[model samples]
Target: MNEALVLTWAFLLAFAVLAYVILDGFDLGIGILLPFARDDDDRDIMINSVAPVWDGNETWLILGGGGLFAVFPLAYAIIMPGIYLPALFMLMGLVFRGVAFEFRFKTIRARRYWDWGFIAGSALAAFMQGVILGTIISGIETDGRQFTGGAFSWFSGFSMLTGLSVVIGYALLGAGWLVLKTEGQLQSRMRTLALPALGGTLLAIAAVSAWTPFRHPEVAERWFAWPNIAFLSPVPLLVAGLAALVFYGLTSRRELMPFLASIGLFTLSFIGLGISFFPYVVPESVTIWESAAPSSSLWFMLAGAAVLLPLILAYTAYAYWIFRGKVTKETGYH
Candidate 1:
C-alpha cells in the first residue's frame, strides 16, 4: 500500500465526517429544538431557517459513509455490524424529519403530528450519531475483520452518556444558529436556551475527556505522557477559552460569534478525538494503513474526489450564502 495515498484518503474521509457533523449538526439541532417553539409561527420560522440548506448539508454524510466503504473497506466492514442498528435508526429519524419538513407545511390539523415527528426524528438521529461515536470510541469487538461483539454491544452506559452528550451539543449548536438567525423574542429565547445547552455540552465534553483517558491506556499515554502532554495540553485549554467566548457571546448578545465559537468547540473536540485515535481508524484494533484499500483503488477514488469535493464545497457555500440572514415571517416557507 502507498502510505501517502492511504493517508490522503484518511484525511478526506475525516474531512467529510467533520463537515457532516458541523454542517448537518445545526439543522439537526434545529429539529431537536423545534419542540421548544412557542407557536406554529415560531416553529415555521425555525424550520425555515434551515429549510434551504438542510438537505444539502447531508451530502457530506453520504460522502463520509461512501468514502469509508470504498477507501477503508475493512474498517467499514468491522464498524457496520456494531453500528448498523443505530445507523438504521438515525436514517429513519432523518427520513421522518425530512417528511415532516415537507408535509408539515402542507397540512393544518396534521401539522402538530409532523412537528412532533420532526422533533423525535431530529433527536433520535443526533442521539444515534453519538451512540455510534461512543461505540467506536469504546472499541468494536472485532476478530479479524468480523465483528465478534454481541448485538447489544453498542448499548452501554458510556454509549448512552455519549448519546446524551451529542444531543446536548447539537442543541447548543441549534440555539446558537437561532441566535444568529433570529431577532427579538425568538433570538432572546434561543439565547436563554443556549446557556443551559452550552453548560451541558461543556460538562459532557469534560466528562468524556476524563473518562476516555481512564478507560483507554493508549489515550492516556497520548495525552498525559510528558513531552506529548506538554504539547497537547492546549486542546483542553482552548476548549475552555471557546466555552468562555460562547458564554460571553450569548450574554453580550453577540449573534454570529456564539455560533462560530460553538463550531470551534466542536472542531477542537474533533481534533482531540483524532489525537486519541489517529493511526487506528477502528479504535484499538484496525489501523488506517491496515484497513486501507489497494493503492489503485484509492487513486481511482481520489481522482473522482478531487473533482467532486470542490463542487460539493462550492454548491454548499453557495446555498448558505444565498440563505444568509435572519429568518422572518415574510422570508420563510410558511
Candidate 2:
C-alpha cells in the first residue's frame, strides 16, 4: 500500500475512535454517577439527560472496531487475542447497559433491577476499556503474529488505577452534560458533582503521567526527547488549564461554559495519549504499517464508509437538533 492511502485509512480509523470516546464517554460517565443519585427522580433525570443521544453515540464505537477490522486486520488480530477476555467482558457490559436502558423505563417492578444493571454494566465496560488500553500501553507479549500472554494479564494494579481514572473522567463529563441538559435543582446537583469529579480526573492524569514513564522507559524517553517534548508538552498544560476553566465555570455557575470546558479538557487529554503513541496502534508492539490490511481491503471499506459515515453524521445532527433543550418529566421516552 502506498503511504498516502495508508495515512488516509489511519486517519479515518483514528477519527472513529476519537468520536466513540468523546460521544460514548459522557453517557458512560452518567452511568457511573447513577449510584450517587439521591433518589429515583434523580436517576430518571440522569437517564433522560442521555436518552436522546446515548444510542447514537455508540455508532462511533461500532464504526471504530469495524473500520479497524477492515483496514488494519493485523492489529485487530493481535489485539483481540491479547485482550480477548476483557473485550468479551466489555461487550457483555455494553449489551447489559443497552438492555437496561430500555427496560428501566418500561416497568416499575423492573426499575431497580435495570438501574443497578445499567450502573454495573457501565462501570464494567469502562473499566474493561481501560484495561485494554493499559495492556496496549504496557505492551503485549507476542510471538510470531500470536499473543502469548496470560488470559487475565490486562487486569493489573496499574490497569485498575487507569480504569478508576476513566470512571472519574466519565463522571466529570456526565456532570458537565447534566449541567447543560438540566435546570434548577438538577443542574445545581450536577454542578456540585462536577467539582470533585474534575479534581479526581486531574489527579488521575497526574498519576498516569508519572507512572507511565517509569513503567515504560522508551515512552519516558520519548516524552523527554528534545523536539518531541517541546512539541507535545503543551497538551497536558492545556488540559490542566481547561480543567481549571471547567472548575471555575462550575463554581461560578456558568452552566454552558462548564460543559464546553469539560469537553475541551477531555479532548486535550485524548490528544496527549494519541501523541504519546503516535505510530503504534497497539502501543509498543505493532506499527500501523505492520498491522494494516491490504490496500485492496482498505479501498473496499472506504467505499462503504463514504456512504455510511455521512448518514450517521446526518442522523446524529438531526436528533440533536430535534431534542435541543432542557429535559423534563413530560419530555422523557414513554
Candidate 3:
C-alpha cells in the first residue's frame, strides 16, 4: 500500500466526519429542542431557522459514511457489525426526523404528531450517535479481523452515559443557535436556556474525559505520559477558556460569540478525542494502514473525491450564504 495515499484518505475521511458532526449536529440539536418551544409560533421559528440548510448539512454525513466504506472497508466491516443496532436506530431516527420536517409544514391538524416525531427522532438519533461513540472509545472486541463481541456489547452503562451526554451537549448547541438566530421573547428564553445547557454540556465533557482514560490504559498513557501530557495540557485548558467565553457571551446577551464559542468547545473535544485515538481507525484493533483499500482503488477514489469534495463544499457554503441571518416570522424558509 502507498502509505501517503492511505494517510491522505484517512485524513479526508476524518475531515468528512468532523464536518458532519459540526454541521448536522446543530440542526439535530434544533430538532432535539423542538419540544421546548413555547408554542406553535415558537416552534415554527425554531424549525424555520434550520429548514433551508438542515438537509444540506446531512450531505457531510453521507460523505463520511461513504468515505469510510470506500476507503477503509476493513474498518467498516468490523465496526458496523459491532454497533449495527445503534447505527440502524440512528438511521431510522434521521429518516423520521426528515419526514417530520416535510410533513409538519403540510398539515395543520397533524402538525403536533409530526412535531412529536421530530423531537423523538432527534433525541433518538443523537443518543444513538453518542452510544456509538462510546462503543468506539471503549474499544471493539475483534478476533482475527472479525468482530467477536456479542450483539449487546454496545449497550453498557458507559455508553448510556455518553448517550445522555450527547443529548445535553446537543441541547446546548440548539440553545446557542436559537440565541443567535431569534429575537424577542424566544431569543431571551433561549439565552436563559443556554445557561443550564452550557453547564450540563461542560459537566458531560468532564464526565466523558474522566471515564475515557479508565477504559483503556493506553489512552491514559497517551494523555498522561510525561512529555505527551505537557504537550496536550492545552486542550483541556482551551476547553475551559471556551466554556468561560460561552458563559460570558450568554450573560452579556451577545448572540454570535456564544454560538461560535460553543462550536469551539465541540471542536476542542474532537481534537482531544483524536489525540486519544490516532492511527487506529477501528480503535485498538485496526489501523488506517491496516484497513485501507488497495493503492489503485485509493488513487481512483482520490480522483473522484478531488472533484466531488470541492463541489460538496461549494454548494454547502452557498446554501448557508443564501440562508444567512435571522429567520423571522415574516421571512422564514416556509
Candidate 4:
C-alpha cells in the first residue's frame, strides 16, 4: 500500500510538471520573445494573447511543488536545500513576470522597464529551471539523504549549457504559440523565428544527450545496456520523428500542429529522463521508495488530492475553450 501510494504521488507530480511545461511554457516563451516584437502594438497583442490564461496556467507549478512537499517530504527537504539558490532566483523571476503582466499596461512611460522585467524574468526563470534539472541529473551532493552542497555547487559548465538550451527550447515553443495566435506579418515573423529556434532546440538536445551519458556513468550504463537500449530506443526515434513533423508543419504553415509536435518532443525527452533515473528522485541519493512520507500521511493527503485535482483540470479546460481561436488587435483580456 505504501508503495502504491508513493507511485501515485510520483505520477501526480509528473503530471503537474508536464502540464506546467506545456501550458505555462508557451507564455514564458512569449515573454522571452517579447523583445522581438516590432512595436508597442505588436507587443500588446503578444501580451494580450496570454494575459487571460497565464496566471491560471501557473497553478500547476504550485500543485507540483505542494504535492512533492506533502507526499515526499524527505525528498523535498533534501532537494530544496541542494538547489536553494537557483530555486530562489526562479521564484523571484516568476514574481517579476507576474508583476510585469499587471504593470505593462499602465503607462507608456513605464512600459519599457516592465518589458525588460518580463523578458529577463522569463529567461532567467527558464534558465534556472534548466540549471536545476541539470544539477540534479549531474548529481546532488548528499550525506546520508541530507543535502551537503554549498552555495555554488549547483553551478557548472554543463548546467550553464543546459540553461541556454532551455532558453532556446522556450523560444521555439513561444514561436509556435505566436503562429497559432497571430496572422499576417506577425505570424510570418514567428515563422522565421520558429525554424531557427527548432534547429537550435535540436542542437541543444543533441549536446545535452551527448554529454549526459559521459557526465554520469550510471545513466550511461542504464541507457547503453542492450535490453534497456532496445526498450528506450523508441523515445529518441519518436523525438526525431516529432521534430520532423514540426518542421513539416511550419513549412506547411500549419499553426497548432507544430506547437503540439513540439510538446511531444519535450514529452519524449522527459520520458527518457524518467526512464534513465527510475528509482532515484534525487539522482544517486534517495529513491522514491526511500523518501516518501509515512503511508498514513500520504493516504490522508490522497483524499484531498483526489477531489481537488480534477476540479483544477476541469476549470483549466473550460478556460481554454472559452479563449479558443485566433487573437487579433481587437482581442484582449477585457
Q: Which structure among the candidates has the greatest TM-score?
A: 1
lDDT of 1 by residue, 42-81 (tens): 9989999999999999999999999899999999999999
Candidate models: Cα lDDT each: 0.93, 0.85, 0.91, 0.89
Residue 127 C-alpha lDDT in model 4: 91
Which residue pairs in model 1 clash with each other?
Answer: none
Candidate 2's TM-score: 0.96
lDDT score, candidate 2: 0.85
Model 4 lDDT, residue 274, Cα: 88
lDDT of 4 at 265: 77
Give the higher-lDDT candidate: 1 or 2: 1
Number of the candidate with higher TM-score, 1 or 2: 1
Error of 1 at 190 (Å): 0.1
Question: Per-residue CA lDDT of candidate 2, range 1-334, in tens?
Answer: 6778788888887888877877888899899989888888889988987888899999998888888887888888888887888889999999999999999988998899999999999989988888877778777878867788888878788888888888888888888988888888878888998999999989988988888888878877888889878987888788878988998899888878887888887678777777778788777778888888888877887788899889998998899889888887667775
Candidate 3 lDDT over 278-316, as tens digits, reads 989888899899999899999999999999999999998
Residue ranges of candidate 2 with Cα displaced over 4 Å = none
**Model 3 alpha-carbon drift over 4 Å, by segment:** none
Positional deviation of 301 in candidate 1, in angstroms?
Answer: 0.5
Alpha-carbon deviation at 202 in model 4, angstroms: 0.8
User: Residue 97, candidate 2: how far off, in angstroms?
Assistant: 1.3
Task: Estimate the TM-score for candidate 1.
Answer: 0.99
To one decimal, what is the Cα RMSD in angstroms of model 2 from the true structure? 1.4
Ranking by lDDT: 1, 3, 4, 2
